[model samples]
Target: MTRLIVAAGGGGDAVAAAMLHAALYGDDERAVILTYAWDRLLVDPLPGPRGPHDFTGLEPLTRSVLSVPPQARPIPPADSTLPRLAAELPHTLALLDPHHGAQGITRQLEELVDHLTPRSVDLLDVGGDILAGGDEPTLKSPLADALTLAACAQTNTPVRLLIAGPGLDGEIPPDDLRPLLGPHIHTFTTADTTSIAAVLDWHPSEATAMLTATARGIRGTCEVRDAGLPVSLTDEGPTVHEVDLDNALDRNTLARSVMTTTTLTEAEAYSREICGFSEIDYERDKAARLKQQPPAKPDLASVLFRLDEFQAEARARGVTHTTLRRLSEVLRLGGSRRDELRSLMVSARPEQYVAPLWRIA
Candidate 1:
């Protein structure tokens, strides 16, 4: 399914991580729908742009490769406008403060919502209450984040507060954050200095994949662009499909395209080998990469599996794997069932295991 992952900050590495994971291992065909929420509020829509615009509705500064809207395209009734009241205190004060009330901006905002609703769009406040600055005047209404979550129950789409950046000290977590987040929030922090394993402990994925700096020596200060991951021989490395990022903003169009796209057949074998390696190397290397320390071995099992899967596919399509390690590797991996194949390769009692291909073929 075409999934929408909305992140709060424009420089959201967590969203990037999610996108990279989706690119590598998602089912059917997939694309990363990235929206920079903070940017949407501050920037004006560009002239024309296609693909997933950096901000929803706001096209690129230049003309787009495809047809799309200029303002943030409200998802009609489904769209929720997560106001930055917590984050934008000065702006909120100007709007709600008595002296500036003559501008009637609050009424204008209300009117805007009224106009958009007729178009089947909704504008909601989707964010944390901590940004509200805890000032009573600022919190004139229910926190936007809370309001947005409540609004989700009324709409067909799920809603979440997309927080960004490294500082997460006072953010008011959703009462139902876990339910609304549903494995979507990505955390980037400076306090995780103990090890890669410790930092990953906080992740829902349980360090199945480690996010490290490319330099391999910096502690607790990893750059998003330089982030590294040990190759687990899985498709969960990077995005395999070339998404324009602009076209994917529209939920309906992207959803339909993903339904018809073909998945890479080699994903099964790669996942199997990656799983086996993760278990075998868990004790030694998983913690090493966490602390900005180098491990004895560079785990490129993911890459290795991808290569082998490709070779095996070629062999099945009438190619050959007669070279040195090719034949034995194929023998070791009898079929394509990831979980069972991994068990067969790694289980203590190898004799008791049977390849699924033997039962079927």
Candidate 2:
């Protein structure tokens, strides 16, 4: 029996979905992943999610649904890692277009279900942010997840909500997520990460990287994102937990509010109304500011100095590790300089953990 997994919230969730598939099905040819083309500011500076129109060479699954093939590329000015993920991941990577909003997403899901006729439909969220109450002060992005939840709730298919690496997104704390989570389904092992190990080297997904790292038995406090949010990596970090679809919808006010949204604009508006802000607005402002600044140059001494200072401070707060993405932010590096920064840091400290993470203590 095949499973249709929805990579809720996109970005790292797609990677997590691949890992989950590996853990559950083990190289199953019948599995399919439906995900959004939304990416981080570092990957896609344009802000927000990219739709079918933003890419070339997408294979149409239905009239409204498109699958991202290995050769598909995001048009210039809009960037993505979906094509790369398609190339690396074993399952078919289908695109989830939110341009038409929740109702449209529901239609697309129904079409996929009818077309594939999977035995089970699963919505996979990398972090537990899909359970957000919309009032969490740390909630940075809720629209995409909310749209996915609302859409899945409307689908005729009985969708299972699987949350891996609870609180890893740094949006909602794990302590805050305990009451919402259901039974622990599975814990990913080192073997489950084999398919995604090389991809993590260049992927800008801090949460999924952390999840896989924890699965590999790396522990302690790890920092992530621009804010350098510290997430405690515990044995539970790699465990997948299931939550009932209806119960999840009941807890997420943003999801309920956007249930009938017909356009991305409408859904984003509800996100702001319910969550007090939309992540896209932050992305738009950041993109505008990025356009004004010149590219950053790699400075090894400055990076080391900043890393020393940050590590001293982070150690005081009990943080032992941090993501390369967070390190790039701390050093004010972006674009190609981020890559250069990683190379310089790795050269300087060969013992540091691989590409996505560095051991500070």
Candidate 3:
């Protein structure tokens, strides 16, 4: 079961600070922590993976913070962990000027998709106020809606939304946000304080109740209970938000979050479904390369033979038997390998590949 926790807050409310805490400890337990930013400090570290091995699936997505930290560059595998590190988008769609770029925001949609190509995850925007572009009173604020919707449709994940502080305006009823979310949606909330003193007086249980009620009220078409875990509002604040999310959202949400930014083909999906197959491919490639050794010039014939060998190895490892229709897609492979892998897995039923020739005898 996957769980997705979307925490939203206004600037300096420490929304990511809250969500980051949840992400660090949530992954192995089948939980994902995500946040959206209007503006924030880039150098600040959220409570997340100390290292890659801490959790099975964990990452962060941001829309550019105050200052870019050395570790905050939007490049893989760094970008792989953090999706949507843009500075900002135009307030209104009409305001989108090719030359007048938004500050501290990820300006490119393709960049987000490419970054999240690996994990199967869900999308969560932390602060709705910023996402809605601050009630800028223009029809052009659809960038957030556009980005969120596109993220859901393209990645096949429903986005979890958060409404905080002034964001809960009259024009946009929280309930309306539900229908917009596809079947994969999951939602949560956390404490928001105007000052450190207010933060000190916050009650964990009471805050959690508010989050639970908010989730129920803002419920989307997707069955919240079926797709996610029960809400748990923690007083631990952003430091432990990820842990709280792990306990709240279920496996379905977690799976969605990892895939939210990922684009998969039938082949890659197949590889994921068939346990041990990917490991087999890795080992086979490793062994083949080792056999080739180094310094040896390859003839055309040898190269052709090597290609044939690779194909045969793939078949033996159950790659060729997949139901992926776009066989030519794999042949044209460059960066689309991820999608191809998913397609192959989702395309064919494993039963059809039972023949000995395709199997390792």
Measured by TM-score, the strongest candidate is 2
lDDT of 3 at 204: 15
- Ordered by TM-score, highest first, the candidates read 2, 3, 1
Which pairs of residues have clashing backbones in candidate 2? none
- TM-score of candidate 3 relative to the true fold: 0.26
Q: In candidate 1, what are the lDDT values of residues 199-294, reduced to their tens digit?
A: 221221111122222111222211110111111211111111221112211211212222222221122122223222211133224234333532
Off by over 4 Å in 2: 335-337, 354-356
Over the stretch 10-68, how does candidate 2's per-residue lDDT look in tens digits?
96898888888878877745578999888867778788999999999999888788999
Candidate 3 lDDT, 93-197, residue by residue in tens: 101111112111123333333444424333333323223312333211223222233333333333333333112222233333333323322233322222122
Quote the positional error of residue 358 for candidate 1 in Å: 55
- The 0-to-1 C-alpha lDDT of every candidate, in the order given, reads 0.24, 0.87, 0.26
**RMSD per model, one decimal:** 22.6, 1.5, 22.5
